[model samples]
Target: MIHEISAVAFRQNLGEMLNQVQYRHDSILIKKDGKPVAALIDARLFERIRRMPARFDALCHRIETAYAAVPEAEGLAEIDAAVAETRAGR
Candidate 1:
């Protein structure tokens, strides 16, 4: 479950919040001035989240290299067709 708490309340109960996240797999969203500012999540989930950018970069690089010889118009057309096909449930 996710808990939305203000910055002040989060600061005042940091330890309790940490325990909730550690033991119950609960996520805490911290807000400042009534707007969400940050979140506290389990360390393992955080690790996976941290790796996403690197993984995305690697995937982008691989696709770019594979498509380097394709013309821009053809590449765009292929992407459009693929998107349309998927959206059309095929």
Candidate 2:
């Protein structure tokens, strides 16, 4: 379960919160004025998401290269057609 705490409380217990996140894999949601402002999560999960953008950009570049000969509008239409066909089967 996630633990929710105010920003002021979190600042006072920074070390303890870090330990809980590192050792127990607990997520702490930090709030300011009752609105969620940040989160303390396991390092492993953070690293995975941190690296995703680069990998995603590379994949998009490859797809764009493969579809280079097709006009932008036509390529989008083709993609829409493919998605519609796949969804129709389900």
Candidate 3:
């Protein structure tokens, strides 16, 4: 679950919010001056994110290989069609 609270409210209930993060794994977005300033998340999730290396390069390599195997314009048209279908909620 995602929860949002003001910085002042979060400070006032810091202990309870920590418990919620630790036990319930709920993410918290803390806003200050009517804008998002910080987030509170479970430590385990943070560690997992820290441990993972970004895979954008691998994804780009796969896309390049796929495009190379097909007519580039056709592949791009297919991709555009798929994106349009997705955006149209099909």
Candidate 4:
């Protein structure tokens, strides 16, 4: 579950919020001045989130190397074909 709270409210109920996240795996979205500013998520989830950027970079690098020898137009045409096939529920 997810809960949205103002910054002030979060600060005031920090202990309770932490308990909720710790025991129930709830996520807290913190806002300031009615605008979203930050979030409080489970530690394990946070760890996974922290690793996403490195994983994404590695995936991009692998794709780039795999397609390095392909011509731009040919690559784009293949991508378009694949997208169309997927959209058609192939």
Candidate 5:
């Protein structure tokens, strides 16, 4: 669940805020003059997000198709010649 706290209050109770985040998986929105300025989120939450699998295979297929539409270079001979030149340092 999300909670809101003033920036001053958050500063005063920073330890408690961090403890709450680690134990409860709660998110805190820090407000300045009643407007939200920042968010405090637990590291574990980001870990979980990173571990979750992507849900849309169609999205991946679309991206691959778009990438494959790009034209290939005209000749590998030019690339090989450049590589040989680089290896010779000439």
Candidate 6:
């Protein structure tokens, strides 16, 4: 379960709080004046989210189609030119 702690308490007991987070892998919801202000989560959890695949390929395809409507180059020549320029540092 997630742990809730007041901002003041968190500031006063940071070391102990970090120890709890390290051992328990529990997220901390920091509150200010009885309202949630922020959260402290483990780094591994953030990495897991970063590695996960996108869930909306259909949405991405629709957006790509809409973007393509703007009408740019018709072939790979433009892309190849850009890549060559980048490789030459220019």
* Model 4 Cα lDDT, one tens digit per residue, 29-90: 99999899999999999999999999999999999999999999999999999999999995
Across 1-90, the per-residue lDDT of candidate 5 in tens digits comes to 888999999999999999888899899999999999998998987777666655355677786687675545634565788999999996
Cα lDDT of model 6 by residue, 1-90, tens digit = 699999999999888888777888888899999999988888898677666655466677887787785556643566788899999995
TM-score of each candidate structure, all chains considered together: 0.85, 0.73, 0.69, 0.86, 0.55, 0.55
Error of 1 at 63 (Å): 0.9
Off by over 4 Å in 3: 48-53, 83-90
Query: lDDT of each model, Cα atoms only?
Result: 0.98, 0.95, 0.91, 0.98, 0.84, 0.82
Count of backbone clashes for each model?
0, 0, 0, 0, 0, 0
Ranking by TM-score: 4, 1, 2, 3, 5, 6
Report the lDDT tens digits of candidate 2 across residue range 1-90. 589999999999999999999999999999999999999999998999999999999999998898899999998898899999999999
Off by over 4 Å in 1: none
- Between prediction 2 and prediction 3, which has the larger TM-score? 2
- For residue 89, what is the lDDT in candidate 5? 100
Residue 72, candidate 1: how far off, in angstroms?
1.3
Model 4 shows how many backbone clashes?
Answer: 0
How high is the lDDT of residue 19 in model 6? 78
Cα lDDT for residue 85, model 2? 100
Q: Best to worst by lDDT, what's the order? A: 1, 4, 2, 3, 5, 6
| Pairwise lDDT winner, candidates 3 and 4 | 4
